[model samples]
Target: MEKDRRSLILDCAKELFATRGYHSTGISDIIEKAQVARGTFYLYFDSKRAVFDVLLESAFETILSSVKPVIVGPTPDRNNILKQLRINLGRALAPLFADRHLARIVVSQAETLDEVAAARMEAFYAALRHYLEESLQEGQEKHVIRQLNTKIVATAAVGMIKGIVWTHATGSESFDYHEVVEEIVEWAAMGIVTR
Candidate 1:
């Protein structure tokens, strides 16, 4: 099927990009890894950069889509809010933890591609910051979160998660996702919730 072939090409390209690095990867390498003819590859992607673009977009979609807005009910239980935070984080982290290749590509190789790629990554982070800032503002209005600079807090939170992912992707030792998620939730709860 056409869809299957396209997915095959994408999977192979993701593997190659993560292992070989974007600049080092070429169309020939991707086609060879994909076991597809030159023309077949062209049918799906115009170039290696095109393939990289699709992969990057896919990664962004997965993470951003995972973040469901934390719902504050009338009761507004602290435990419930923390539970929602844990759920959101776990969902967001699941794909990356499951696929080291994807994690490496998104965290390490995304910004290295070119100016366009760097800008795309920046935009992705900006979207994340905006979402966090909005959520923090809502929490403050609901009296669930303390008063603080939402912009700075959002930026710092995004940076912390990025740094954690970068370390996990690039480090030799593997981490347990559940533990990481719990630690992050605890740290966030301590910093975010009103006493």
Candidate 2:
């Protein structure tokens, strides 16, 4: 019951945030939408930022889980895998783009907030970088990618992907998201393929 109520509160808050923006979505709005007492909210989260933190955490976890299988399981050559990579990546990252409130909150507070949000963002980015580095390292060992600095490349790749995500989310559809992702995958693997 407790877990369900907490999840319900989260779901309600996410909806409110998506619809009304984070700054405007008060605890009262959240509780009303959740159909739970105001006091119940305090049991789960201390502040609005805390709720945002939970949402961000879930988004990261979803993205990580979505990408993990494609990276960890045995896969084919880079050329053959680009499509799968793009698809998996699109699905993984598309959520962060789709959830306007979560995306806006994380991106906006990334540099503006004091210790808590800063630390949370830093940890999440570090974990993402670490995952990308490991994936690149394995691809390097398999001769599926270039012998470049995996850390830099991975970080840059993630940054590029995030940029693309932001662009697609905020800008008009100048190009398809799949096209953008495939382009990134292609460029990333081009110089690495051996004869």
Query: Would you list the C-alpha lDDT of every candidate in the order shown?
Result: 0.90, 0.71
Residues 122-180 of candidate 2 have per-residue lDDT tens digits of 77778888987887787777766668888897788778776765555444434465566
Worst 10 residues of 1 by lDDT: 166-175
Error of 2 at 68 (Å): 2.2
Model 2 regions lying over 4 Å from their true place: 1-8, 15-25, 32-36, 43-46, 69-76, 168-175, 191-195
* C-alpha lDDT of candidate 2 relative to the true structure: 0.71
Per-residue error for 173 in candidate 1, Å, reads: 3.7
Model 1 scores what on Cα lDDT?
0.90
Q: Write the per-residue lDDT of candidate 1 for residues 1-195, one digit (tens) a residue.
A: 899989999999899888889888889998888888999999988988889889889989999999999999887888889999999999998988888889999998998877888899999999999999999999999999999999999999899888888878876767899998999889878888875
Tell me each candidate's TM-score: 0.96, 0.74
Using TM-score as the measure, the top candidate is 1
